[model samples]
Target: MATWAQFAAAEPELAVYGRELLREEQGYAFLATVSPGGAPRVHPVVPFVADGTLLVSIAVNSPKTRDLRAEPRYMLHATVGDNDTEFAVRGCAREIFDDTGTKWLRAHRELNVIDIPLETVLFALEIDRVDAAIWDDGPPHRQTWRAPNG
Candidate 1:
């Protein structure tokens, strides 16, 4: 898996477009996780990039949190606006247990006016793959990146 920085390094243009899409429209994204019964669960999430990592702060009691804890694999898709542009990332989440890391993420969240409660869990979404599609007049432009050995 690759950190956001690594993905950016590998595919600069796609990374920039993906970041723009992800941060657009209130920074909302759809996170897909696997339930304990092996069902797919999708939830809206506010995602941010901190310390070269894509992270999300989820309520500790949220069902998505439980799903993530039980199964780390996830697919996060940027919420499309009026356009046909699309961006998505597939990865595995790692829970943040270190106080310093969580504190840094919390501070960043606060700076962005993200209202994450204190009773929340932070997770790093390590990227295994990223895909993007941009449409204008003709055929849609598509791009994809995969982590080395991921």
Candidate 2:
């Protein structure tokens, strides 16, 4: 798995486009996690890149948090645009309990103009692979990038 910075360094163009798609809808992205019952659960999450990592803050008591704790593997997909542009990353989430987590919560609260409770937790989405496509006429332009150790 790789940090966002590493991915950007490895695939500059695709990384920029993917970042745009991820932040297009107010940093909205769909995060897919594995439920304890082995079913897939999707949640709308706000993702932000901080300290070279792609991070998302979750409420400590949220089912999403529970799922990540039990099963770190996850997929995060950018919200598709009107033109059907798509971007997604598959990876494992690593829980953060350091100052980075605190900084993320504070920044997130400020950005959204709301209060984020202290019980919130942050997770870094370590990328295994990235996939994207852009559709215009005929077949869509597609690209994929995998981490060196992924």
Candidate 3:
């Protein structure tokens, strides 16, 4: 998998749209992680993409957090609304636990959520592939972006 900066550098325009889809207000997306038994477990999540990183903050004590720590491979899919625009990424996730991560988590007031019982932790998904299906007049336009081996 490649870093978000690497993917953005390779495909700026697509990255812009993809990032918006992931960060849009009330946006819907699904995060797929490997279960202990090697099965796929999908969960609804909110994605935040900024400063060349795509991250998702989940409950600190959640099973998903442990799942990602054990196995980083993941698939993230954006919900295609009535517009029929689709976005997805495949990558490996890594937890961000330093002060830098803490600051970011604090800056985003949305993550300061009170209803959640457990604290939240952020995980960055270094993107490997990006796919989009944008609606047009006729057939939907499709595009895929891949990072160059560096």
Candidate 4:
């Protein structure tokens, strides 16, 4: 298992998908999870990468959210560029609707208009592992790491 710090250092290309990139490519994220019957379900969603965890606020009535709650294990696939320079990670998720989660959701009004229950658990992903690809040799770089709760 690679530590988050090691992943960050090895996958320098991920820097291009930081928060600023979220504003433009946020909608391209694919949230994939397994259904109760062992079927596959994948949907396009906006994701926020904060505190080393990824967040996607779903409506209380969303089928995906329901499926996710039942099965916290999921994979998020995000890509940029024609060469398919993508990043994918599988992690457990839990819903978040608490005041704090709601506040975070509200701060980003552009995300959605759902009232977002205040009891939602923050589907926090510890990022056990990640797979990333870089198609070009533009330059060697590193992404700015956001301190947790900073």
The model with the greatest TM-score is 1
Ranking by TM-score: 1, 2, 3, 4
Query: What lDDT tens digits, residue by residue, belong to model 1 across residues 40-81?
Result: 999999888877889888899999999999999999999874
Model 3 worst lDDT window (10 residues): 109-118
lDDT of each: 0.87, 0.89, 0.80, 0.58
The all-Cα superposition gives candidate 3 an RMSD in Å to the true structure of: 2.4
* Candidate 4, 56-145: lDDT as tens digits: 767666778788878887877774545555566666776665566666666545455534554443554445455555556674332233
Candidate 3 Cα errors over 4 Å, as ranges: 24-26, 110-118
Query: Which lDDT tens digits does candidate 2 get at residues 31-144?
Result: 999999999999988788877799888988999999999999999999996588999999999999888688877877777644567788899999999999999899999989
Candidate 3, residues 1-150, lDDT tens digits: the string is 787788888888988787777764536689999988999999888777656778888897777887899999889998775588888999889899888776666666555343333268789998878889999799989998876652
TM-score per candidate, in order?
0.93, 0.93, 0.87, 0.67
Name the candidate that leads on lDDT.
2
Please identify model 4 stretches exceeding 4 Å from their true place.
1-23, 110-122, 137-150
Report the Cα lDDT for residue 88, model 4: 69
Worst 10 residues of 1 by lDDT: 100-109
After the best TM-score superposition of candidate 1, give how far the Cα of residue 139 lies from its true spot, in angstroms. 1.8
